[model samples]
Target chain A: MRSFVERHTFWAIVILLAAVLFLWMIFAVWPEWLIDTLGRKKTFVNTLLNGVTLGGLYFLVASGFTLIFGLMRNVNLAHGSMYLLGAYIGYEVADRTGSWFFGLAIAFIAVAISGILLQYLVFRRMAGDDLRQTLVTIGISIIAADAMLAIWTGTTYQFSPPDWLFGAADLPIISVIRSSGDAVYIKYPIYRLAVLLVAVAVGVALWVFLNRTRIGMMIRAGVNDRDMLAASGVNVQMVFVLVFAIGAGLAGFAGVIGGTALSVAPGEDIRYLLASLVVVIVGGLGSITGAAIGALIIGLAEQFGLAYFPTYGVVLTFLIMVVVLAVRPQGLMGGR
Target chain B: MNSSRLFSGSFSLRELHPATIVTVVFLIAYPSFASNFFILQIGAYSLILGTIALSLMMLAGYGGMVSLAQLTVAGLAAYLMAILGDNSMGVMGLGWPWWLTVIVSVLGAALFSTFIGAVSVRTEGIYTIMITLAVAVAFFYFVRQNYVLFNGFTGFAGVEPPTLFGVYWRDPVPFYYLTLTVAAGFFFAVYYCARSTFGLGLQAIRDNPRRMRALGFNITLHRIVAYFFAGVIAGFAGVLLVWFNGRVSPGTIGVDVAIDILVIAVVGGMRHPIGPFIGAIAFVLLENFAIDLIDRERFNMVIGTAFLLVVLFSPDGLLGLWNRFRDRFRFRGNALLGAERVNKDDPASTGSLEKS
Candidate 1:
């Protein structure tokens, strides 16, 4: 970290100044001119929070996608299907058993098992053939999507979080100063904050697992050279199965969480799939840190675009992707 | 002598195979016997879709780049035609002449495709698919959201083909012939280009980009040019598609339709130019008749299963399966004919398989 700052002093100074300005914006009462130009401080803070939380959700979906692609070189076009299926399964279980946490566990396990079946039955046979594998996944997604529609129909279903997570929580930051000279604190949803916390925990855990653990080391090595990893007496296929299961499980877990935050419907699969694809593309393929940064940028761009330009919101995300492709085709964190 | 042969090769009827003559005759005479529904929906629709899929096949099969944005390119042309020409929506219809609108639309789509290609060509292999798919989805969302220009969700309707030479072109018979002519023109264009220097160079680059680069070829330029050629074909098909449907909507260029184009190209057999048409005909037939076998909503399931089976069993699709069968039959025939005959057919069969 120190070396990064030292080597790129100009960039470091720019980042530091930006961070300080952001901190000031968050803490200080906004001037009348600022509020006139940028709207209420409440909306600005809420948009910022929403974007961060949305980024957390995107990170959950894309990290798994990047992991599988990093290790196995499989694009898994059916991943969006897995997410929708997970949400559907979670909704059903939660509705039936009345335990949202149980539903989450069940969704993860169910989707992970399906991932194993996919790896074993479909991907295993055509291993190392990227195009064919991608095509097969597309076929699988089409079938799965239709089959799901047959079963679930077109209705949107939203999950009910626990009573404790149902309402908003007040934060320390002041949104406005009332005529009485009293500051009014900002209120945000508890569930979204929890989701953000969980995402951070999962990300740190993933970093530790990949960087410190032996199996994680093996997975990293496999990503670099599968043949060499296998030849070195490691069970490479076993490692692949493990990675696929975890990657798929994260998607399933995120689906339940996302379904709660948003809603589950027929077209949500395509939405999340697009999200993961764009995230990975901007962040760089096969990099966890890249996915996180990519997701945050996309999420913020989307929320702010919606708040500011409403009509051309989608163009902002697309412009970011095009710029990234033009300037850094390998991605922000992706290795060449 | 070689140049003369090359010139005559594309035009000579005597040099054409017997099957080609029969097919052309059948197509020219199709409108007389076929019903209006069959002519417009099955025949003309298939031809337009096949032409669009052919653009994808040209890029994927020959260039070794599988892009999911071909339909998006076609969609842009459709939207351009609707916006620039006449439309009932009264949004941005400039009431331009049909010929000018078509020329502009085609050029617009080609330039858009070139831009997409330039951005995508920075990466290699599987990245192409992801990048193109994202671009396709982005276009879908953009058109659906921007109301001032694109008309948002409702889109443009009552988009009619111009009447020319004292005939209403949108009528079933004329439309069928128009589409057939265009499809056949592109079909043979792709066929001829496959044997031309540019196409052969593309195939060589697909096989070994490093070696092609070592040989002083401009790899990126070759690919971008391929994209421009494909865009023209897709752009023409897009114009025809809007005229056929009499409308252009965000739904017309949805992500599902994009994938369907890929499915058609893959299912038909990407090895040759004829593959997309064969795939499109089969797709249109199944789409029109799948209700007889199963629920209309479950057609995706059936096609998806068929796609899975094709990918699993024969990656080169129906053409590969047919070629294998013929090779086996030819081997048996050669066993009885002569060992020298077997040797002559060997390289041809292997060469065809290696093209993809």
Candidate 2:
């Protein structure tokens, strides 16, 4: 009984606070039947699931941004353009092949190769020069964005996964919810679950790769000091090429996932770029752990803010960034 | 023979002589030859942008701090003038006269810049850049969202330039000459300041702050003073901008335009005062005319490419190239021209990024 109290106390307090907040919000708004639809227990659980999946997608997008910034002391302003490009590529591939899975594979490969080639060609030459590299990448981003606009024609395109992945289902263990209206009594997309799963698997893979591989060691050493690594006979050029590719690949992967979730549009690139920049700034530029922490905080803040304080929802993220900068300019997890 | 020639040429290029000649010729001939609207609109716009960029050059070029919020400061001054004083129309207005409003607005901008400079100057390099960016973004949101002060997003409209010498100054020719006179005045002021002790001290701080501090310079005060001076320049430009557009919107001060100012400073070369003029003229003309010929959507591609190429190949900027070209060519007398031995390390020194 003591252990139960320990586990439940925090959640019980949170629930009570949430209930008070909800009543306050309802008082602000005119009474409506919509609240009843939203108030169902299953709906709450589904919304929670949806919020986690969204956070998972944000993690995927911010991960590449963090890695590129952390490893290469260069700000890739064009990362947004890469995201947009990846989405368009995936959409077109899916359209042509009539297969979402095949399209995603093609999108990942195409964006990954392009990202690597871009690094090899341009960023490799701009090793020490930070500002110039920023300008060049911005130039590249503008060009790529324009090219995409020419092809995509400033239109928003939405894509849905195959029929099998269209509706939600109940897991064997979590049978508290049963089927209702062609879903498991909670209408949420299965693709969102797929995104969450993929993000988790990729996150795990990246963790293993960074901690357990020779290339990872080289990357770490390169991040610490490229000059020292070069003197120590590591092919620093090859390492940069690999790092840039990996960073770009992660962004591409995120693009496909995000595009499938949020419709692909022309200006979406700038939004993601800004989001990623905010994440990196708040998380600390060079820390992967910081990226995760930052992403989670921003995601939850954004979701909660949207639910409770829609008007100031956007301000919450920026305010947190300012507070973080004020308290610790190095960021939450930043060592240097 | 070499010693005699060097001695004779040493005093040839006086500080104000070339600038005076150019100013006089430009003021007299530009309005006379250029078309009516071109003389007024494009010319006035160029001058205003040039003046704004000049203040940025003082901060970024000399002080080595790139404040993206200069435009924000300018916007603040403009909006304050409209809201707090004679420019206001509604019940919320202060209802003061034009001159008082001008002083208050400009002072307000300076005070705001001082506050920002205090926080930002402590950080170095990219942190400084990001901090300024954050401030600018924050102000952008504050002004855009606050309907009571900035009229929400619509901002104030119908700001009129002050009439002088028995004429309404809104006429294109009058406005053009007005801008020219203002630009020329500020140009000389900045040029003279570069040769002044204070300006030299600021440059010293830029080159090496620790050494400057050891030499007994109050580094923070110097930076704030620089920021105040920059605020005045930007505030003056802000006055011109409101008059030009006849309306102010939140979109006027944006991240893209802030970055555009940086591009202008860098493209003209950060090393010289005249760089902004050359850069501004080229940028304005290219952005306006080039987009007409090409796809409007892809025009940014041209700008982006140009920016990259210029930063990569000619970090010294266009004016530096012009000086080089001028030195390379000779006239009928076959005399080798150009001031070749000017010391770049000296704050008063002219030319490119090379330190003498």
Candidate 3:
């Protein structure tokens, strides 16, 4: 325990806590109280839940981005297209099969195959050339987007669960609050719970794969030093393709889940692509833990910003990124 | 050692004579060939995009930073002009004249770019690219949502072109000249800057930042200044874009178009000033006619394939190909200086485009 506490990170965290306490005592207490006294509303609990739920979506997207970027140094600008495709596929499947579960499965499989093909055919050919790879992927993204627009038209597609899972749950804690003159609303969406569960499941599986499996070891090795892994006779090319496919599949899966939660529109690709970038930027590139943490922070910031200050929601996320970048160019998790 | 060996590295093998003369003649004669429509609309569009590509070239080709937000700055400028001018349909509009709006918008864009630069310049390579992308995305959403100023999804329209010397300036010939003159002016300015001390500093930073920092140059400041300079050019191009479209729409300045500019710079050859023109020509022609020839759905496929082919076969871009062919014939006299040992693989020298 002593040895663990002596770790550099532990000591720094302790120092950080001390600073936070000092700041709270010096700056926050009196002003916060005064504002509370002056008829300002505080939503500490509401914002927390909002951030966590929204963060699940971010996690779903950025997780895939991190994995692909980890194995292949190539930046797949077309990741967003995959997500959008997944949503469209899921939407169609749901419409045909009338089973949301089957729709999710079909979307995931379809996206995985397409992603693998993209990796093997296009991305594989453009390895070791970052500029060319970026340009090509960007071109592919534009094509994909145009094709989607052409096929889907410029309409926003939405999805909702069956009657059994239609509405929110009113727990005793929330129902009990209604006794007061002022009514407090506390209805939790089950879809959010499903997303939260999927994020956890994916997280655990990813952790196990990277830590316990031989292929996972290779991926970890590849991220750290591809040249060394190649020198060690590992098939670096195969790893890149597998990593890309898996990452893309994750995004597709997330898209299916996210589509049910959020509307899958024509321009959602660009928005989610930017979200992925923000995740990778704040969370160190290729770090799953970083991606998770970054997604949570950004997601929550976005949700609360929307709820509290609708006009400045986007700007708030941008500010967070800019501030984080100003302080740490490497990110919250430093890049290798 | 041969006398030329010591002087060879110092003096460029090809002199700057024919290329310069040709460029000057082309600039002078371009407007002559422009019929009313070609002169005013197409010509102006080409020049505006070319100028934007010039600023992008300075960053991508010279500074080695691929920025996707350059168009966002242009969009912001356009939005600012609409929001600040008297003729604007926007809420909270200052209703200022076109002149004041232009100046203010340009300044706003410069400030935004500088802020982006301040954060992005701290990192190198792809990190800088992603950082700028985040900034662009954020600004895009901000403008898309806030209805009072940006008009939400519906952007400002009816931005009339400037009138000077009693001319409405919307006519093809006058607008053509306006864009051509500005493009020419910016072209020379960038060329001169590239030839100046600042240009050398930028090149040094691009080639080796650690060494430049070791040598006591303020690398961040140089990068930020480059971004500022680029933003100013983009801002001007934005003003022109509104004039050309007769309106500004969020759809027009989307991420796709931003990426398109980067594509143009790379396709034309990030190495040379003339590369953007070559790229712009190809792009404009492709955009105008490709949909008719192939399935409109597959138009991007053609562009993607073209970008991939260029990058794989010729990193120097189309202009680089022209230079190589020109060099093959121009240096035929001396066996040592000629085709057998033709060193056309160097990207920097390709952009330099040495003349004989």
Candidate 4:
């Protein structure tokens, strides 16, 4: 961090000033002119919070995508299918067993098993052939999407989080000062806050798992040089299967969580898949940090665009991606 | 390489293969015998789709870039034709002459495609697919949302082809002829280019970029130019496609249709210009008739399985399968001839070599 600031002092200072301004905007009671120029403080805070939580959802899906790509050099186009499948399975399980957590667990396990089967049966045979592997994934996604549509019948399904996680909580931020000179706190959904918390915990856990653990070091080594790792007496195939399972499992888990936050249907796979692609592209392929940063930027852009410019919300995100590609083709956090 | 042999592959009637001659003759005479349904729905539709898929094949097969945005480019042309020409939507139709509209829409789509190529060519290989897919999806969502220019969800309709030379061009026979002309034009254009200097350089870059760069080729410019040519083909096909349907909608360029284009290219074979047309015919036939064998909803499943099988067993697609089968038969014939010759020379050795 110090080295980054030392190397790019101008950028660091600019970022610091932006951070100060942003913090001030979040805390200070807005002036009448400011409110007239932008909007009510309540709307601004809500949009900001929504962007952050949505970024959390995007992180959950894209982190796994990056991990798989990093370790296996596999694009895994079927990832979106896995997400939709997980959501469907989660919905069914939760409905039957009367437990959302159980459904989440089962969804993760089932999807992980499917991922393992794919890695073993399909990808193993065509190892080192990147294009063929990606093509096979595309084929699988088509079949899987059609099969899911047949089973689920295109109905939108939203997870009903438990009663405890339902309802909104009051935040400490003041939205407005009433005529009586009393400040009104902003109220936001508890479930969204929890989602953000879970995402942060997962992100931190992933960083530690990749950096501190022995297995994590092995995985990183494999990502850098699979042949060298194998030559050094590592069970390269086993590591690959394990990484694929975790990656697929994370996507499945996010499917259920995101389904609760939003909703799941036939086309959500493509939506999330596109989101992952853009995030990974902007954030840098195969890096968890890159995925998180990309997700946050995209999520914020989406919310802000939707709030300010309704018709061109998607274009805003696309413009960000184009700009990122133009400036840094490798992505924001991706290494050369 | 001899310069004569290099230039020998240019399009010329005298050099046309017998198969090419037969195919052209059959196509010209097809409408006379076939019903309007066969002529329009099957023939014209396949040719239009084949032309579109041909663009994808040109990029994937020659340039080694599998773009999912070909349909999006086609959709852009279709939308431009509608918006710039005339539409029933009472939207922003400029009511330009059909000729003007076609020229503008095709050029617009080509420039758009060149821009897409410029953005995506920053990355190589698999990243091409991901970036193009994102761009395609982004365009879909944008068209679906923005009503000011794109007319939002319900896009322009009542689009028609011009009546030329006292002929309603949209009529089945005329449409088939029109599509056939365009398809054949692009087919031979791609065919000739594949053997041209630029195409060979592209294929060389696909094989080994670092070496090609060392050999002093402007690899990036070559790729962008390839994209421009592909865009031109897809743009023309798009104009025909919108006319065929008499409307343009967001659904026309959805992600599903985008994948369908890729599936068509892969299944027919990406190795040759003729492969996309062959695949398009098969796809059109399956799309029309698959309902007879199974539920309409299961069509994707069947196509997806066929795609999977092709990728798994015959990566070069159906053309590759045919080549392998013919090679085996020819090898067997050669072996038999060799055995006979050996027998004439030495019977004992021939027995040892021929028993199997």
Task: Assess each prediction's global lDDT (C-alpha) against the native.
Answer: 0.91, 0.73, 0.78, 0.90
- Among the numbered candidates, top DockQ falls to 1
User: Ten-residue segment with the worst summed lDDT in candidate 3 chain B?
Assistant: B347-356
* Candidate 2 vs candidate 3, TM-score winner: 3
Positional deviation of residue B251's Cα in model 2 after best superposition, in angstroms:
2.9
| Weakest ten-residue segment in model 2 chain A by summed lDDT | A172-181
The model with the greater lDDT, 1 or 3, is: 1
| Candidate ordering by DockQ (highest first) | 1, 4, 3, 2
Q: Clash totals for all models, in order?
A: 0, 0, 4, 0
What is the C-alpha lDDT profile of model 1 across A1-336, one tens digit per residue?
999999999999999999999999988899999999999998999999999999999999999999999999899999999999999999999999999999999999999999999998988887878888999999999999999999999999989889999899999999998999998999999999999998899899999999999999999999999999999999998999999999999899999999999999998888899999999999999999999999999999989988988879999999999999999998999996
DockQ for model 4 equals 0.57
Candidate 1 local lDDT, residue B80: 96
Could you tell me the lDDT of residue B266 within candidate 1? 90
Give the per-residue lDDT digits (tens) of candidate 4, residues B228-265. Answer: 99999999999999999999999999998999999899
Whole-model lDDT, model 3: 0.78
Interface RMSD for every prediction, one decimal?
A: 1.5, 3.4, 3.3, 4.8
List candidate 3 stretches off by more than 4 Å: A1-47, A160-164, A171-176, A179-185, B1-23, B29-33, B294-302, B324-356
Q: Which stretches of candidate 4 lie over 4 Å from their true place?
A: B1-14, B333-356
Each prediction's RMSD to truth: 3.1, 7.7, 5.7, 6.0
Worst 10 residues of 3 chain A by lDDT: A170-179
Sorted on TM-score, best first, the list reads: 1, 4, 3, 2
